[model samples]
Target: MPFFKKKEPKKTKEQLEKEEEDKKAEEEKKILENEKQIEVAYRFLMQPEVQKFSDINKRVFLRKRGLTTDQIDQAFKRRDEKKESAQTGTEQQQITQQEQKASEENKSVLVYSETLEQKLATALKNGFLSIQKSNTTELSPKIFEVSNLKTLVASQNMLKEIPDAIGNLVNLRVVQLAECGLTNDVISDKLFSLPNLVELNLSKNKLTSIHLIVNLPELQRLDISYNNIVELPEDIEKCQKLQLMNIQNNYINFFPHNFTKLVNLKRILISGNQFEKEAEDALKSTGVEGLFKFLSQ
Candidate 1:
């Protein structure tokens, strides 16, 4: 018996036209975005703040200003050529000096950045911020005695999860993982193992719960802002040294019951959450102290 293969459904002319129109619209949107970025690059190149930075920092500043590497190079090249033209009659030896002087004078400058990942690699080699991933199939569990490491930032990567072995870096003081698409389930609970973690920023992630962080003894600053958090750990007061906590723009409806006990808190950015009307009104009127007092009652 012969078996017949299923035929694929063909798209209609109208559907094809619609797809083309959608593609064109998307391309136009991207072009507009690029044009805006180019304008921003030009403005950023003219900023007085850009004048003080070294070549590497200039590249970083450009990247932060939303300019693509290609745009940055093009801008820098144009600025350099303009300088070369201005000093046409200068001696060849003086030409180099003139170029250097003009390059420093203008707001435009450029140098290559390998990638954020590559920058992280250099930071790792220097023994402060380490990035260790082997392949897509499996991650390497190589632990480091990075006792003196002050900060570890792993942001805007395809990282599904941080390895459990990160806890081995016991002396880590600050950890930033903003905009990494991390969820609570993906992150290892061993993060709390870092006893010396004074600052922890997990902003712009998909975290639904972060009660595990309350165990960090020396945590002074916690930024779980812009997440899916609805409540904090009841024992949040355990972080006796916490001086600042930024939980703004989350799903939190109320402050923790023992929140008042955190007398060390100097700043608590809890706006843009699902707070109750009475509490929110009190907070909006009298501030954090009022909010704490209302919660305490």
Candidate 2:
């Protein structure tokens, strides 16, 4: 008997495509598996908690694990709320306990709109925190300890000067003062020295320039829209970590150089500037060619 003819090798275009797709899928799967393994190994570093409070009512116990104070506080905060909600007459007790905790820790917690000044005064009198925000015009320049505070939001207020004391919040990560009355003359040198600051929102203010906040090392997102910013600082190239900048509705007459220093910039809104022809042409040549709508409109 003649040897059985080998099965005809089938290699159609569809089959080739299928093979390539299968290879890609396999590669992606491997990559995903590796990523998952890496994530599992390092998750502890992402959300460190100082302690795991299983039951605060029983006794204050801290978990001897890799955790930070922030993580621990966050984890227990929700648990405390749930526990209090489940028990009657616990709200009053919680208030007393919170006051005691704040006193002992020498921490500040102020979140009441009913006579803010009065409430802050009481907290300050209790020595829990140094208070600020006495008025819509002036922020206390001696409140935050130049090494503490994590967040500061004083938006929708009428103010022209950002207190030099603001630099005291060296650990600040998020600061939102949008719609505040600010001008180019009201620059604060201390504000630029904040090391941990990441998000800054100064939109809808009377800003006339960008140099005011051009060199924050860790600043990631900046919102300066609705201001009178006509130009950016030449030293803006130094803000290496800046990721997003919104400079809409300003009278930008020229393009700032080294727009390339914004290596991580993913979105830029310049849709309301009065650009000269040369400036407009410059923007179009750069990858930001789409910002022409400002001039067209």
The candidate that achieves the highest TM-score relative to the unseen native structure = 1
For candidate 1, the lDDT comes to 0.69
Query: lDDT per residue, candidate 2, 1-297, as tens digits?
Result: 889878988899999999999999999998776555444423422332311211332112122233333444444454446446542222435544854774565433222222343333343334223223424455644345324556667777667688777776677887887877777668587877788878888899887766857658898899988998778887776788887888888887665566655677766766788866555555556634444333334
Clash pairs detected, candidate 2: 48-67, 48-68, 49-67, 49-68, 146-168
**TM-score: model 1 vs. ground truth:** 0.55
Candidates in order: C-alpha RMSD to true structure: 20.5, 21.2
Q: What is the TM-score of each candidate against the true structure?
A: 0.55, 0.50
